[model samples]
Target: MSLDNLPDGLLLEILLHLPLQSVFQCKCLSNRWCSLISTPYFTHRYVSHLHTNLQPFTLLFECKDDQSITRVLATNSDEPELKSLAAYVHRQSEHLWLEASCNDLLLWRSKDDGESSPMSVYYVINPITRQCMALPPITLPYHRSWIQAGQFRVYIVSSNTREWSESKVLCQEGFELTHFALCAVPYKSLLFWCSNSGRLLGIDPYNTRCCRSFEQPIGWELDKETDCFGVCRGYLRICQISMFYTRFSSILRIWELKDYDNEGGGKWYLEHEVSVNQLVSKKSPWLNEHVQQKYPLPLVLAFHPNDGDILYLAIELKVLLCNLRSKTVEVFCDIPHDPDTWNDKCNIINFVLPSWPTPIPFAPLQNGA
Candidate 1:
């Protein structure tokens, strides 16, 4: 019997073993295959299979310049599909800005011109499915500016609705919500923003009223530049570097949020602590050259999604992978620009591509009526 004559159950089983890109190509063979691959059941099963087999995910570094050109670097440059996805997004629009990235969805913003304005359009895209949904335009209040006082508005788009909604978050009386909007971190069902004062603001997109602020982790200093926050191994984690002013020694501490909804706001447990100088000297001496300088401290770019002990660090223009357990460091890749240039215009995003395409939740009436 031919492959086309195979039963649906058997065909699905075979397709699940193929690579993600191959499965995408299989969809174009016929409408029947496309429908089968697009079903929720197929996606669920395929994702489970990928997890069981330990499919590796890629990391993307995005740098934006003055001309609105975004430069993306992927850890796994050998993968054609990953490179194509990055190229596709840039090709779509030169002025496109990547706002935030969740599990399988990427939130993008496009301005009407080269300058900032209130009339900005947002889009939610799934690279795997090659689908895009453009949200309704947003108009801010005329009186208040983007960072006026201690108030900021968050625009939210839900899978159930075709239109976008807004939520206002009030900060502490004296604190200003500066730079936090550009570095919003999406984890689980809530979005988290860390202020320069080391305070954390979390909000649930589904319910705008459920917003809360948590104190900074113990030992973290306010207005310090040696800290970074990210999610690792299914937990929210933060990495902080403390230096000894007298000596050239610095200690790196990793903290994990054990409980966030407790009465004390949240509880953080010290996960890992290691000496930066010793770790670098033992394995990679090149990185230790810059450790003595107090001005340019090593920056933590991201943590390994599957392994909590592995970390990605930027020492200057080069990115290195350090394993805490083995006390070893290796250069992962070198970036063309300075890593310290990451600011409002430049960003480093950690993207993990899901095995199966997530269905775009566009409302039925969005296409018409």
Candidate 2:
């Protein structure tokens, strides 16, 4: 590896654990690891270390601000007049900013992401200790004759609370099984795991204690689609849906919520069923050793909003760069097509998806109906 004693940030920290088209073909391998892997903190430290359930520096919102006001962005890449770091603001939400982000937290939701009404998340705020809280929106409580709190969703198994009323949990509403999510539990801690909502809980983040409830494992299916997005694939929290189901071809379906507790209702189960075409054939030759990648698995991961245990999956259709530490699977359908077409059809439409969470304007998801 001698180009004159290579160390460009340790070969961009091993090309930030290589895989985002091999960090852009190692930037033609030579302009100094292509400006040290095209700095954005080298894909934010290759996605915040590729895992450990992540958290490194995220918050890329801009629902309006460009001058219209309503911010909370971040990228103060050491600021120089806000390379991007706006911070926070929500007096009218302006037009909605965050939809999901973790590891320095930010998931902001006012009433969008399919908008059925009653949806909330804005906890985990430390805009440098300004302190914030206003969660409990994604509604749905349960049993008043089978669900109705506008239909359900408040899935915040945990939000790294800084003040959450003194740490959460109440269950109240109508409780029989309400439906919940927003999770993290690989090395343990950070949760809100429920489905069809039974009795398995673990609260704190100021919803205030029940601490741990149990019993769950009947049919199991708590994915009240907020476009169903989750990440944490080795201790499972997998949930991702690009909409498919030749009757559940199962492009991913995991649910392993344990800490033990069963009161005839929940302990939850079904810990397996992910086959995005066998993770696109085990990520085709390890994503052809990086450049144009590939993927297919029941894939969908998040937490690369700008690195911190860098886990970003949602392959061949956006949110690229899979695998960093624990759950790193890669296969962009042999992404190479300068003309091979990465195997044509616009590589099934422009190498799937590797851009757009913001820059605003988004659409596409209707194919096949």
Candidate 3:
């Protein structure tokens, strides 16, 4: 009748249904459980099961100045929880930069004293396990004599080998990139990053040099301020808002990259388009004028994993779930902020982990399950 007395197969079945965090905690209960759970066969099965169920997505907001991370469940209305990531860094570490996230694995850069060090300080974390590991540093190539050298690298831990690997990317030829728009979700064994020049670079975690490159969606200028990229149902999604200099109106378009792995360059297919005027008129009529001048259009957060018609967006300090099917908008939750105290020095940025049915443990697969 006791859990320890249960058959091994039944125990694993029960563990597979448990949340990923709980499963990780269960590993510490006993050596038998740990060995069984850590087995390659069990790990892959658990991951495969979770992927089929479609886990709910979570949002991680970074307070730039304080270097603190806040986690909120995007599926429902909930208060944000400040996650303590201090155990991973030195006590003196003040700032942790969120470079990117894929399959619930977060990539962070450590800023020590703001002075450029030849060694890169990067960390990879699995929020569920509360585990963090630092990566070996690589010196970046100098750009121009005056400008400091900055390189973008993605550190991905192999599920099979349990080893960390990184991919190095360069600025596009004939074009100078200031920053890159990190993709919301990684797709098909590739992590996609969009440069300021509207170029898409795909990083192959297995091989750094075999990386792939593609042009951005036609006619889309992915300025860091106005446009962003996300993944919905394993498709590359880009939402862009453009404003006219002469007129006060703005246009918003959402497109998906289809057959992105095509032999020829893949084509972008328009998924949905809406006008800022219509959204303002229906959602916030009072702020019609402020939208074009004072406020930027809502940034696309994440698309619903099961429901293709639903997507999340951030406007002002609120996260809204916009449904294309009903043409309705509802507030999912509010971004954490202090109204009593106003400080212009604080850094705040919002991000959503778009990978649905988040990837499971890294244990290699055995024979067929």
Candidate 4:
């Protein structure tokens, strides 16, 4: 019997198991396949299956000098494996800046060879599907001014419709944009940014009117210079950097958002506090004895989606898994660092996840046809 004669149910099951790239390529084989693959029903079912077996991991983007590479490392409970994503996603002549990710969709801005600008090219892609769509230039009010004023906006590009939709504009008093530190949690339709004053600003992509703000948790002195913000499993995380001015001792405070079911209904709670002083002293007792020795601690990367007690931290050269409940820190994975560019001072490491419920497909216009 010919493959085309297969039942619709059986064909769908086969398509679901195929790599996303194969499914997309099959669309060009015939109209029947295109219509079948592009249907909302099939996309929903396929995405649901993707979510059911999602493998949450830590993503790190490393830029050594002018060259860059992306590494996707395993999280706690997973084997120590690192996959270079740039080899699969980036081109030889294109330099891409990852912006955010949602629904298995990754957003990025690309600059051509020798191009110098703040991302005039934007894209939304699903690496699993091996599909990508370019987004039109975003429309915003005073775009550059907003970036300079410490106010900014988040926008979502719909692949189904091939149009740009405004998420929200975050303009809060005393919230100055910390350039190179803004991160988005697309699963929750939220954008998180840490201000220069140790305050965190979270914006609901669904709501464009205003954003919600929270001061740094009490009892912790935030350095504002090194604190980091991130979200995992829909919980907002703030890693505060504290140092004893007189001594070289340092401390890290991890805070999470509790009761964040709605746009503005969550409150910040102190989750775990890691003693950098003890950590460093444990590593080398003689180093701590010298009061002038300063250790640059790590930043919180993301919390494990399935485990509440597990979180990842990115130190200078490695990512560590801190089991808050167990109070034990173990090596999750080691990131590659080039000694040549180690002192370049412009490198930043962050994560981009493949979330569920991929971008909604564009609905055909009824009157046009």
Candidate 5:
């Protein structure tokens, strides 16, 4: 019997076993194949199969430049599906800035474009399905002049809602919410925004009233510039680097949240501590020859999604993947380092690509004749 005459159930089983790229190509063979591959059941089954079989995931890096151009880099550079999605997103809106990523969905926002109002529209995009949804504009409440003594409002919206809702978050006697523009870090069902003072504002999209404040880790200094927050291997982790001026050395400490839903919030347990100076010793190739500094501080960009021991660090202009347990380092990539624009113009996003595309919830379908 010919392959075309195969039963739908058998065809789906065969297609599910193919590589992700091959499956994507199968969608273009005919309308019947396209419909078969595009069904919700197919996607769910394919994703489950990939998870059960332990398929590898790709790490996609997205950054924006001063010219409002977005650049996407992936660990698996030869993956055509991811590359195509990145290029399509770039072509759709050159000014779109990636704010956050959860699972397979990317949250992006267009630049203000010098509008008189401070609010900017947000978009949630699914690369595989090429579905885009525009969220209602949100007016920031952290404006310096708009402060109302001890309280501020946080605007939030959900995928199912068309309008934005506000929640009043009270601050301490002297503390104020100042860093509302920073990208939110999505952990489990809650989204967390970190402030310069080491405070975390967590909000639940489904429950507009469920807003909570998490204090900084015990004994942590109020230095926000050197702190990085991320989720690694099913745990919410935060990494901080401390520089010693007299000794010309730095220490990196990572903490994992124990119980996020506890009545007293969560407690951070020190998960890992590595000496940055020792990791990049004098004989290490990570040291730049041009810079004569004895100890070059490394910025923790992100943690390895699958491995808790591996970390991605940015030292000067080079990005390095360092293993804490083995004390080994490898150059991941060289990033642009323009001193003039580095501080104010750079945005980095760590995107994890699963084996199968995830369907976007509540996204409107494209019109097909």
Candidate 6:
């Protein structure tokens, strides 16, 4: 095609359909296409244009290269330059990598070459803008040794400066129960889970008050000791059993959480709960389309970023967009699989779009990260 033949706007539209890397490649096609793609007008269109306004979704997987794995971002579109963002916080778990992305800011941690230990670092980077803010050193008040089998998680809340509180989840099998507290928040609301005693506690961070707690009904008795439940939902979720036990005849529930005295207390009213059979049947057609593969775990669910009345879920083969307004669920296909679809090898992780963007707190990348 003759580059000069097309109107500038038409050329811009064509470039918008391609990923940034491919646009870079087109630079070799001709000086005109190259110069036009570099213009602010074309760059803006290329950044914002997406087939679905649906927040972009990407998959996270670790590649083992000589006992060291490099993590990178690969969208459903499979842009070839997805590896350009490689060299992020190098030593991290799948969960940590999945947690890095928020609205537009990506947070990650890496090792400090000079220090004996990996760098206890945090940075906010925006791939689109390619800006990063590396935060000053932050240390948890408690001794690391005190925390048993501990792991750290960072929660980024939206603010002018992008609020982030680095915290760790601590547990001790030797103690009466496993302890979890929010170290980054005002005061510390520590939660205690006793798989042996079937007890759950919520402690006021400021006064260490035994705020309020509910015991799962006796029917969840085994949960008191041998079994364990973790909150997959965010801050509002508490998985302690009902204080009273009834016949156990239902599936896992998504009970609506209620707040009391500025703390989560009182009975949990279910927002919605689907039985095992119905939930299975609903996903069956989609699974059969895959020619029979075990479905991914506790199907990921989250509030749609743009719509309050809807929620979104991800299965192996497709994304399920549920309309809360109409109380109907619609299945959409966006996942990419080749003719070699019998996929295995890596575990799948699900995450929502980041809601906050932090300043790029990172040191200047070598020629820019």
The lDDT leader among the candidates is 1
Judge candidate 2 against the unseen true structure and give its global Cα lDDT, from 0 to 1: 0.38
Q: What RMSD, rounded to one decimal, does every model reach?
A: 4.2, 21.9, 7.1, 7.0, 4.2, 10.4
Write the residue-wise lDDT of candidate 1 on 77-123 in tens digits.
46555766666655656667777777667777774552456687888
* Tens digits of lDDT, candidate 5, 1-369: 877899999999999988776787798898889999999999989988878543233444444555656464535455555666566655656666667777667788877755476788888877765667888887764443534246656667756657787777655554544333356677767777655455666777677467777777775767544367777877877777777678776677788888766465687888887766556433466353322264356666677777888888765666677888876676777665532234434566666667676666545425320
Tell me the TM-score of model 3: 0.69
Worst 10 contiguous positions by lDDT, candidate 2? 343-352
- Model 2 CA lDDT for position 253: 47
Error of 1 at 77 (Å): 6.9
Q: Which one wins by lDDT: 2 or 6?
A: 6
Worst 10 residues of 3 by lDDT: 79-88
Total colliding residue pairs, candidate 6: 21
TM-score of 6: 0.43
TM-scores of all candidate predictions against the true structure: 0.84, 0.24, 0.69, 0.67, 0.80, 0.43
lDDT of 5 at 89: 52
RMSD of 6: 10.4
TM-score of predicted model 2? 0.24
For 99-194, candidate 4 gives per-residue lDDT tens digits of 565535666666444424333677665554445666777534443333345345566665557677865364566567554455543325556677
TM-score of 1: 0.84
For candidate 6, lDDT tens digit of each residue in 30-126? 8988898767776556545652544444444333322444443334433333344333434334333322344455555443334444435665666
| Predicted model with the maximum TM-score | 1
